[model samples]
Target: MSAEIRLPGLPLVALPGVYTPQDDTRLLLRALEREGVRAGSTVLDLGSGTGALAVAAARYGAQVTAVDIAWPAVLSTRLNAWLCRRRVRVHRGDLATALDGRTFDVLVTNPPYVPAPGSRPARAAARAWDAGRDGRLHIDRICDAAPRALRPGGVLLMVHSALCGTPATLARLTSAGLRATAIDRTAVPLGPVLRSRYAWLRREGLLSPAQETEELVIIRAEQR
Candidate 1:
């Protein structure tokens, strides 16, 4: 189950300015499959891009909520979910802010884990992947906020590159009173964003010139 899971070639109607599905998306889907999501399960897709994960979960018969900070991404998610005949509650707000006072059976995220030179992006396409230096910015926030957003026995399945510091993610989730482990891992090439900052990333010791691919890990944390 280490390979990316293709969604049977389902067409996603992604509009301009929305982040399209790619390797990380498939990887997250593979991890989601392992969760054994039951019919009518409540699922949340934080930072939902194009609502691909939401649609996938809906296809599995789960009630899905897809949240993104970008308005265009929200509309794209809504459109794609409708295109797939899957119902998704779409919202545009900072991560988890729009989801207050709600809990879910499962939470899945492929956040902006790419280490960036500065703070999170503002109104740029880079918002999809430009995480702050060391790439734990959103990851830490999720680990902190996820616990309350999950019901007892709830699970979180998050995917990020090894360069962002997997141990930190595991430690954070564990410290947040959840049992955390890397349930799955796979290698993937650097995307355009990472490629653009290759030199800085190398200097920061997150990568090497000889490296062609970075390992992506799915961290599964369960409520205690």
Candidate 2:
């Protein structure tokens, strides 16, 4: 079944199959709202599945550009924008490549942070969930490109799993000349039982069995 999420004054639909919005998206949206993103600010939503974040930003009066590599995601963003009666630019491509030379005042992203072993290369959910070996593949690229795409003093708010090199992501953003900090965090219950990657990690002694909690980390960074 599909979940319906109401974000303050915005209405958005979550996908029934494949991907869904986690609590981290809500936390990131709240943080962005607090950061004063208004009509004048241009916002970018990376990996914008189902257009929840983009719709929320548009409702708040920001010009939003929603990008996803998958065609389904692009279609979702377009349809959601129509449903909400808001204008959002929807593009399909990898990372910010579809954006060309465009820059934004606010950038929001909920990237794939799952470290799936031996997954297919171009599957939609793989693009949405898997992030290479340590799950930092896409995260690293986003952090590196954000500084260049953001206006000085502009903010990049991102949501990622805490289990996959979160500290390294923070360090990467800092090294890329952006001031980074964790704005919010939440522990979500795991859905997978014994077949989960977490379970395998536990078995391999990589992670403790008590680490079934999925930690969502919200990071806020500003270009220097």
Candidate 3:
């Protein structure tokens, strides 16, 4: 199946400072659905914003665990999971070190992939979307950890903008010993965040002079 599964209306609540689910979020959810999370599957929702994907996975009978570094996100995920009547184990910690001894059948992440001129923000709302200059800070960490975080025959689902370099992500995952490829792609109008940084992106050659839309892709990686 294609990675373009439609997302359902999830009863999610995002607190102030927590990221509200947007295009990337919806795309990740669509990929998760297309993967067909099996009943009682062990699933990890890395960088869970509103825990929308976690809750959806739980609805499909997957045992979901969500991790985020921000307090607002941690509480928001818990609140939303409760609101949706789903059981999700939510943890708050740095993404790089969280879940040190854990692995799951499926790992899904839609991390901070926006290319930023400055370092990744700490304790700011921007932390939800801003990555470092190359926008591969969290993406790299996720790729490094995926091989160990996923059990054999497990799957990793990730979504990000083409501006961040889709081929790079696929190559990284492959080097980490997983078979990976883009499963779905769609173009979206630049959002407020991208629009705000249009000049910087253009200057850095991350975006073209006249480009106003960004392509988003869902990458699926399978463990050998």
Candidate 4:
């Protein structure tokens, strides 16, 4: 496991209540570059926290759209897009309905994967990371929608903690008819949020007493 490091590219501004870009975000960016967004391609950034990924894709010549349920995140993403001089269509809505009839060539996401003690995260900043008890709330939904959200042969790049279950994610995506596999991964120390729930996570058998780092995996799934 190595220390968490943020990859450099564009500057982003996260509004007070918005989730700031982190390691998972930077990792997703790397994956996006590897996939090579074609100029004029359609890209969607689900749960675009600080718009880092969306702006990056736009800079790569993709027409990007970003969605986040939180208003602050929406504002933060719009602000970042403006600052970066990239045009990204941003929307504020729940994941299920955000892109009602939309499909894209590439879908990039870093959804919340923190296994929380609650059945659901309360509104506000907690929604940024507090996925349900098993931490697959958002991830599962994303997988289910991947098929309909992508164009034929489109690519889906997602980043999340291994704490939630990488195999499960790959399985779900494959079951949905996408060819999916983990493309990149790294282990980094748990941050303050996970540290705060250290006891609960240990008791839930999701973490070990000596485990201080969580593995983050970037999964790449292609629509056939």
Q: Which residue pairs come into collision in candidate 2? A: none
**CA lDDT of each candidate?**
0.84, 0.79, 0.87, 0.89
Q: Compared with the true structure, what per-residue lDDT tens digits does model 1 show for residues 62-167?
A: 9998899888788888878877888888988876474689999999998888888865353567778777888887888998988898899999999999998999
Q: Give the best candidate by lDDT.
A: 4
* Per-model TM values vs. the true structure: 0.93, 0.90, 0.94, 0.95
Model 2, 186-218: lDDT tens digits are: 888764522367756565454666765677888
Could you tell which candidate, 2 or 4, scores higher by TM-score? 4
Give the clash total for candidate 2: 0
Worst 10 residues of 2 by lDDT: 191-200
Which of 3 and 4 is the better model by TM-score? 4
lDDT of 3 by residue, 1-224 (tens): 11112347676677888888878888888888889898989999988878889999999999999999888889888988898899999999865555688889999998888888865364488898888888888899888888988899999999899999999999999999999999999999999989999999999999998998999999999999
Error of 4 at 144 (Å): 0.6
Root-mean-square deviation per candidate: 4.0, 2.3, 4.6, 3.7
- Lowest-sum lDDT 10-residue window in model 1: 1-10
| Candidate 2, position 142, lDDT | 90
lDDT of 3: 0.87
TM-score, cand. 1 vs. native: 0.93
Candidate 3 C-alpha error for residue 219, in Å:
0.9
Where does candidate 4 have its weakest 10-residue lDDT segment?
1-10
